[model samples]
Target: MSSDALAELSAQLPGDALLVGADAVEAYRRDRALDPTAGVPLAVALPRTTAEVQAVVRWAAAHGIPIVPRGAGTGLSGGASAVDGGIVLSTERMRDLRIDRTTRTATVQPGLLNAELKAAAAAEGLWYPPDPASYEICSIGGNIATNAGGLCCVKYGVTVDYVLGLEVVLADGRALRLGGPLIKDVAGLSLTKLFVGSEGTLGVITEITLRLLPAAPAPRIVAAWFASIEAAAAAIAEISTTIRPSLLEYMDRTCIDAVEDLLGRGLDRDAAALVLGGSDDLDPDGRDVAFMIDAFRRHGACEVAETGRAEGEALAAARRAAIPAVERRGRLLLSDVGVPLPRLGDLIAGVDAISRDREVTIAMLAHAGDGNTHPLVVFDPTDAVAAERAELAYGEIMSLAISLGGTISGEHGVGRMKRPWLREQIGDDALEIAERIKLALDPDGILNPGAIFEAR
Candidate 1:
């Protein structure tokens, strides 16, 4: 990472495409994870097109500098954390999108924000379903990178479900278009699927072809409050067994108080847990809603009621705001661990026990119908002991999920922070195969080094 080399690399692209200077480079050091171990980079590259991205990759290949491809910096898994003396390739300037009404597909550059895509699709009476909590801020590229899942994913499916194609620039700077707008194409290996959640390890995705659905009916919502966490978990498990909810979310009391404190949203802070169920089926009998209400009461709900669209959307918005609200208390070690649907209660209960054992305040929330939960361990940064405990609690939650035959991450990719535990979950044989595949595609080991796997 010599200045001479950076100058040469900078000269390869347009003057405005490269970012240098201490402050500019520093700003790109961490994503939303705020990974403490993130390093300073040599320079940042803001490529506006696939050709510009190829120029950067070619220059990096010539110089052997690690390249960390970054989206909107909204990632939670430290997947975009900068590498020391490496190149930070920012796709923020690559925002180009086109919607094909006849094909019902969106061909977009990596930098388009998820909300922008949704709005663009909505204008044409279409819908793009994978709405992660950070959809408003997260880029479509980031969503594809992590295979991001959202509230309505229980019904519509995750990011991978919508990605129909991709144009990726490989490690050797060869741009390959993997798939197309065709609904079903098994012509070759599932290369498009490989890149969807690859987290920039295999290649840099410049464009995406996403499948879109016709607009759905406006959802009706239900809010259920429980006297005990167990009761809420029971209700979620029961409802999941019977009905496929458009949205099923869970928030523990700690999260409730945090959201209330932040937004003054009048959340029921006294309740042990709050569960929300949403449906868009347009069934005149409202069968799903009725079933959910019955399950809540049977599982000992303190109060259960169906609310109007306004209040329901507001509550859902609050659920989406949980992370930022809880962050106001202290720095958070966020854990996205999920278990089998039937073991959802066990996972939640285990997280609680870990928090108590480690003496940390753990605020919990989930896309409950899918059994994926975010258990946030909060601690003051200045308190070294507390931070250590928070880290321990975070690991414990992931390990507990593993013990229950679950994944360490349901949507957030296993970035550097979760890499150590990845082998434990996938086992040595599977990890070895993944490493072989990684080496096969990225023989130079330059693409997003030390991400899903260690730097070669």
Candidate 2:
């Protein structure tokens, strides 16, 4: 934490691997969450290899400095937020990747962008299916850290489903390799799965081994506009139970309005909800597409239509741009709360009620097929009253999801922003066991001190 200690650490690392100046380190201090309390770090370490990461971790352990492991800093949760007098160990410079066509896997460095990985896989006639909304900017390592899910995850699965192995540096700077390319390796504990969504409390992930699949057919999309959110929810529930969908998404009025404002894409500004259903299978009967259209109509959708892959991709891009579009309106306190499919309607209704009571604009969107939702609460920071209400609405939404027998976070990890409510969701016993595991791996508690767990 001191200049002398930083100097010593710098000497141990390769030249140009550390950044100490205030100006150079400012950008690494916070993630997309922009947690106002994000701290100024002692220095930002950019390690390119596992050995460099080990050196940095050893120095941090020696100094008892907290190390916040970061990827592309595209996290909506404050998982990578820096600690005061801590070291922000960024993997941005570790951009090495290899594709094994024989094994149909990708062994990649932590810093590789998800899009880059997808492109690489595609070149080899393979595909990495976990496509988060921010895939273009987010890192594959961060995806593994949070077990990220995307639009297609309803069928393709999340980041953890594709992660076959990882190379991680422990708190004491020792590297451990878990799992491998073999599809049926049950040799020991399911350790690889454990670290997939651990955020960064246990250790720093330097590299990942991902499972890939033969590229899927381009999907056709079904767009439906509803007169009521309840109707849309009912349609989503029915569609989810009846058939397998590549993607099933919902955007409430506020989200649609925001995106429309940003893109002017002819979205129905007056519609109560918009549901996008998709399928990649080239069914001769177009059964799934017809079923979705029928469900939409059955649930009183005002308009329903099927579109080809070209149009579907455009709509998906708009969906991906929702968060940033909403951000343009005001400060956003994003909530990744989810409930059972049967209770999806109830969750949205409860959120609506909370918004009315809090008097805040809550833009709701979801990967409806999987029951995960992101309720974006927008408010002006300078308006103290509005800001306070937004905070209340955010917590209330999570509580609502928990009450409905759901999770506080479906894909986004329990970063510091969501930590206070994590215990509420997982219960005391599960949390206690998790804490014990953290202690076992990070005894000094120097690895991401305030991420998923408090510093021990």
- Which ten-residue region of model 2 has the weakest summed lDDT? 1-10
TM-score of each: 0.99, 0.99
For candidate 2, write residues 114-153 as lDDT tens digits: 9999999999999999999999999988998898999999
TM-score (C-alpha) between model 1 and the true structure: 0.99
Candidate 1: tens digits of C-alpha lDDT, residues 2-109: 778888888888988888878989989999899999989888999898998999999988888899999999888899999998899999988999999999999999
Candidate 1 RMSD to the correct structure: 0.8
lDDT of 2 at 330: 97
